[model samples]
Structures are given as structure tokens and as C-alpha cells.
Target: MARPTKFQPSYCDQVIEHMTEGASLTSFAAEIGVARSTINEWMEAHPDFAHSVRIAKAKCAAWWEKRGRELAVAGGGNPALVMFGLKNMGADDWHETQRVEQKTTLEAVDPLSALLTQIAEGGRRITDRA
Candidate 1:
């Protein structure tokens, strides 16, 4: 007679994900209705599994920082936007850059008006006099 093998599931990725979210292996096991032993096995099999989940959860962070810099540069802040938002506003981090940028943009520009301006006129860029 052949012996039965342990069950391994594709959701191992998700199971490891939950565990990385500080979901204790036991709780993660229960959440996915699997055994804690199974989650442990998955983590053991793939070391990058945990790192992947953490990165996935915080995926928006790096992206927003990059775009924040983009918008600041486009809005004429250049490198100074980072400094002004960080040092002057006590931002201390990219997360704060988003909040400050959002607040300023909202207070300063009406979306509909900005849209109309863009639609009414081509992107009229000014040539540098220098």
C-alpha cells in the first residue's frame, strides 16, 4: 500500500502573506482554515515568500513617493519640494509628502477648473529665458 502525502495548496502564497502581516501562524492557519504546520512548511520551502508579501502589502509606498517627486517637479518645486515638504512642513517621510501634496493641490486648484483650462488650451509650456 502507498502512503498518503501532505496536502500543499497554491494559497500557500496567501497563507504566508497573512502570517507576515503579524497574523500568528496559528491564526493564519485558522483564517485560511489550514493547519499551522502547513504555513510553516510553506515558509520553510520559499524564503522569499515572506519578503514578497511584505512588499506586496506596502506596494503603493514606493510608487507614491516616485509620483510625488514627479508632481512636485512638474509644479515647479523641483528638488525643493522634497525639502520644503519634508523640512518646512515636518513631513519626515514620503507618506507625509502625499498628505501635504494632496492638501495643497486640493486647496489651490479646482479640479473642474483645471480640467477646463487643460481642455481649453494646449499645454502651453514656457521656454526658459536662460
Candidate 2:
């Protein structure tokens, strides 16, 4: 027998409120006395929970972005640390990117033709030696 799930409809609002305050999903799980994997399971089992999680993620990113903007305007916080946090915590909204282009050509060769060429070269070498 499995243990009863701790999922509740109120958890949807709780997660949104938690993450909107710049708290991580893992921290929310810890706050609710659940494992991170349990949170994932809840999302899979509950559609409302999944939607709330999505909203929570966006709100979390917005919170980080707001903090970054404040630091940039006030010139009081460690800019590098704020940038690192934004890049990591709000990666979808803040991060550096690079673009690369590559070109290549692939030619198909007949295995039998290659083998025959090698044999012909060996025959020429033998004739030259003789």
C-alpha cells in the first residue's frame, strides 16, 4: 500500500505565492515538508497544480528581474552577483547567447569501386617491381 498524497487545491495558490516572493520550487517543497520529487508528482497528477507552477515560474522570473532593475538603478548592490542570479534564476529572461553556423559536404563512394582501385594500384606496383 502507498501513502496518501498530500496534494491540496490550496497548494496551487501557496506555490504561486511562494515563488512570487522569489522563493525556489525546491524551497516551496521544503516549506511544505515534501520532497522536490513529490512536487513533480503532484504537478503530473494535478492539472491546476501544473498551471499554478507555470505561473509561479513566470512570477519568479519577474521578481528576479525587478530586483536586477532596482540594483541597476540604485547602484548599491553587487552588480556581478545580481547578474549571476538573474542569469541562473531567471535564465529564460536574462542570459547571454551565442550563434554559430557550420557547413559541411558529404560524398558517397562505392565500396566495391574503392576496393577495385586498391587492387589495380597493387597490380601496378607488382608490375613495376617485376
Candidate 3:
């Protein structure tokens, strides 16, 4: 039989709070005197805890983005770092990517054949005018 888990229900709230506050799992585990691998195991075993962690991660991303904006407004932050952080952390919502799709119909006729046809047509017109 497998040994029982060391997870405590009491730590749920704190874990969620810390995650939303931008505390990584490793740091949070260290702060709570738990192993990082143990936390990951708890998340896998507890569906509710996993859901809470997901929500907290979104909140953490929002917090980071807000901080980036505030720093940019204050003009005291490194522009490159701020942009890189925001672009990576808020990629789905903040990153900009352009997609252009051009569609064309292609025929099996060769380009030289088409050009020669045009020239032949022009020659016929010229001869008629002569």
C-alpha cells in the first residue's frame, strides 16, 4: 500500500493566496516548510487545489502586468525588461503578431508561354494595322 500524503487542508488558502501574489510553487513550498515536489503531488491529487492554482496563476500574471504598466508610467523601469516580461507573461492578451494570407490561382501553363502568347497577339494586331 502507498503511504498517506502529507497534505494539510489548512494550507489551501495560504497556497492559493501566495500563488496569486506571484509566489512560485518552489518558493511557496519553501516558505511553508514543504517540499516543492510534495506540492506538485498535492496539486495532482486534489482537483480543487489544481483549479485554485490555475486561477491563482492567472491572477499572478495580471499582477505582473499591472506592475509593468506602473513602472513604465513612472519612467523608472528598464524599457527592455518591462517589455520582455509583459510580452512573455501576458502573451495571449498583450503580444502582437501579424498574420497575412494571400491566395492566388495558379495554372499549369508556363510563364514564358503566356508571355509569348501575348507577344503573338500583339504581332497579329500590328500586322493588321500595317
Candidate 4:
């Protein structure tokens, strides 16, 4: 016989509530006496639960961003943590970095050597500039 599932329908509501309150999946799982993988599997098996979790996580992100902004404005928060939260919450508007790649080639690097050679050969004189 197959084993019974540990998930209960009511857990969907509880998970969403906890998630919106800033609980991460791992922490939430621990709080509810389940493994993180179990929660993940439950989400995969229950589409409605997955959707609810997604919404809750989005709200949680917004909540964290708001908290970060509040701390930044209050003048006593960790600047690094605030920036990290803001950057993650609003990546499109608050990207912390940009990457660029450039390539180039120099073709006439021997000009100075050639000039010295000419001077040595008496083809040009040091006083030519004067």
C-alpha cells in the first residue's frame, strides 16, 4: 500500500500566511515540522498552493523592500542591507551593476622604435624638432 501524504489542505492557507509575513520556505517548513523538500513537492503537486505561494512571496518581497526603504529614511539602518533589499525587490529599477566587454587592437606600436632607428641611422636628427 502507498503511504499517506503529510500535507493537509489547510496548510495551503497557513503557508501563504506565513510567507507573506516574511517567512522563507525553509524556515516555514521548519516551523511546520516538515522538510523543505516536502514543501516543494507539495507545491508541485498542488497548483493552487503553488500559485498562492508565489503571490505570498511577491508580497513578502514588497514588504522587505518597504522595510528597507523605511530604515534607509530613518538614518540608522545598515546601508549595505538596505541596498541589497532594494536591489533585489526592484531589480529593474535598482540594478546594482552592469557588465560590459570591449575588444581593441593597436597596430602601430613600433613607431617609437622606428623613430629611434631612423635617428641612429642618421636619417633623422635629434635637432630636427628645433
Which candidate leads in lDDT?
A: 2
Q: Which TM-score value belongs to model 4? A: 0.65
Give me the displacement of residue 66 in model 2, in angstroms: 0.7
lDDT (0 to 1) per candidate: 0.51, 0.88, 0.73, 0.76
Model 4 Cα lDDT, one tens digit per residue, 51-122: 887776776677667777788678786778757755665455567576899999868769889879878887
Misplaced by over 4 Å in model 1 are 1-22, 52-130
Q: lDDT at 8 for candidate 1?
A: 44
Among these predicted structures, which one has the highest TM-score?
2
Q: Which model is ahead, 1 or 4, in terms of lDDT?
A: 4
TM of each candidate vs. truth? 0.26, 0.76, 0.58, 0.65
Instruction: Give the per-residue lDDT digits (tens) of candidate 1, residues 64-103.
Output: 3554567766765456645443342222343332344443
- Pick by TM-score: 3 or 4, better one: 4
Stretches off by above 4 angstroms in model 4 are 84-95, 104-130
The root-mean-square deviation over C-alpha atoms between each candidate and the true structure, in angstroms, is 20.2, 4.3, 8.9, 9.4
Q: Candidate 4: deviation at residue 8, Å?
A: 1.2
| Per-residue alpha-carbon lDDT of candidate 3 for residues 44-118, written as tens digits (9 for 90 to 100) | 888777777677667766867877878868878677766675576556777878999999997688988876787
Model 3 misplaced regions, further than 4 Å? 78-130
Name model 2 segments beyond 4 Å from true: 99-116, 120-130
Ranking by TM-score: 2, 4, 3, 1
Task: Determine the backbone clash count of candidate 2.
Answer: 0
